[model samples]
Target: MRTFTVEIEKDEKFYIAQCVEHSNCFTQGKTIEEAIHNIKEVIDLILHIKRPKLHIILKDSLVNAL
Candidate 1:
């Protein structure tokens, strides 16, 4: 698992959440909790779609064989 930093701030009507590691990733919600949840979902989606190039090994077996 990887960890990323998230910064949240309140605008005029919504709470905005942005990933410090990924400037292009951000989301907004009516409440701080909602904003955090939305940002988490967004990060998951972004990471899932743009997976890192690193490889994983388990019991000398390579996952994501490619």
Candidate 2:
């Protein structure tokens, strides 16, 4: 398992989350909760498809695997 930092921002109609470790990976939803769920799904898909290329960070700590 790998841990990555996810930054979430709220917009006018949606919440967006960007995974710091993965480029071109972002998730958006109607609500903050939905955005979090969507991001989790996106991260899982990314990890499955992209494997590993960048360093993962968690809570200001560098992580190899979650």
TM-score of each: 0.70, 0.66
- Per-residue alpha-carbon lDDT of model 2 for 1-66, expressed as tens digits? 566677766566776778887767788888656866777778768677333232322332212222
TM-score of candidate 2 versus the correct structure, residues matched by position: 0.66
Clashing pairs in 2: 1-66
Cα lDDT of candidate 2 equals: 0.63
Best by TM-score: 1
Model 2 CA deviation exceeding 4 Å by range: 49-66
**Residue 15's C-alpha lDDT in candidate 2?**
65
56 Cα displacement, candidate 2 (Å): 13
- Stretches of model 1 off by over 4 angstroms after superposition: 49-66
**Which pairs clash inside model 1?**
none
